[model samples]
Target: MKRLIHFAACLACFTVFLLGPTIASAGVSKKAQSDFEKNLLGKDVKALLDMPAYKDGLDLYVDHKVDKRLDERGIDLKDLSKYLKDKGVGVERDEWVTITDAKIDSDRIEIHLGGGGEGHGASKNAAKKGAGYKRAGGSRINFRYGRDLTDADVQADTFLPLLGRVLDTSKIIGVVIPKDVAPQFQEAIRSRDVVVGMSYQMVLISFGEPDQKKVDDSTDDSLHETWYYLKDGHRWVVKFVNGKVGKVQVF
Candidate 1:
């Protein structure tokens, strides 16, 4: 009996050892991580930052951290306010860059840009001094979901809005839109307004899953959906006609 008990304890320890990492980041859905890797990895995207960025990552928390940092409101800013203030910007605003890597941790999704931060070799290769010196182009955007997450939380359509906080993936999956497309998308998310011509996916990203979803069957020909969302202490209604935003009614 003692031996059996000892083996059980050992098995418990072994189980913890094997499942530790998974348990640590269990809040992050594996599907969500996989989706990001499939979509963003090896993709060329435009930078959205208005200021200088660095090899060190810019941490973007989807939860209350934005409000805490007041980042969206900053007009005049220093280079790399979130990290590496002393170092020069590795990437500039609107610069086209590639996503070299992506990682989802227990608290954040770490997306690397321009080769996932500058390497020592790149920095040494271009040893020119002052602002004109060109270091390797690289930076990172760490998207933080502060609470327990689900696959729905980071699915491509909805996740893109949050991702717009750093990289403009307008050329997502090889579909290139205008330069202003991503910024407009980011604005839509901030305002939480469903605009006309927005597809069903865009609405999901900007407004999230509706509080209530119902199909309007009056016409009986084209597919129409009416979604209800509770935002800013009010219930708003959005009507989708033929899989596109048709009308947004506020109550």
Candidate 2:
């Protein structure tokens, strides 16, 4: 009887020892930690101050050692420390533009663009010459029309894709017109102000040539010339049949 009681006590003690951390961790409030981690995951903070949650979390984790919650999520303290030094998210800030004034909407995050201008001189000259300029002001011109970025733009990471949810085309552009706009923008061949051909040229005129183009030879000849657009966080495939638009899907 004594031996059985001793073995039972030892087993109970061992079980408690093993389950102590798990129970304690499970009971810890993950609300704040979750919100903080959600904002930090897949994000880098080089300048820290740009993102309030990152800045605060970094401070708490490094200085106050208040990172037990995050530690449970497989995040390394050293990685956070390096992120602080880098002053950017994911990679170096020099490689990617830091997004600021990020307004989190239901589907997309509207990031405020800052920094120098591009194509403004040409736009101004065209406007001065009465060539009809639609939007000409700052570097933010690229974001004005909601056009996807080109290969060059991708290298620069100028337009970051929004995750979590897909944005409605009408909501993104704030316009409700026929789907012909895609073709008209690409081919520069407008159709009676109704439907555009939505060819490669039209896409270039609107969103510019894709950074990367792929052709699927696996498909039959009737469904060839399928072009893919990759920019920021968005990917789109435009299918053409017999040199005409068949379907366009963006993700």
Model 2 lDDT per residue over 114-217, tens place: 32122323333433433122222211111222222222222212322311111111122223334645443422322101122555545554455666665657
lDDT score at residue 152, model 2, on the 0-100 scale: 29
Worst 10 residues of 1 by lDDT: 73-82
Model 2 local distance difference test score? 0.35
Error of 1 at 230 (Å): 24
RMSD of 1: 10.7
lDDT of 1: 0.66
Candidate 1 residue 185 Cα shift, in angstroms, is 20
Query: For model 2, what is the error of residue 223's alpha carbon versus the real structure, in angstroms, after optimal superposition?
Result: 6.2
Please identify model 2 stretches exceeding 4 Å from their true place.
Answer: 1-196, 215-223
Q: Candidate 1's residue-wise lDDT over 154-207, tens digit each?
A: 678887777765666656633323354567665564444578777777787666
Q: Given candidate 1, what's the lDDT at residue 54?
A: 50
TM-score, prediction 2: 0.25
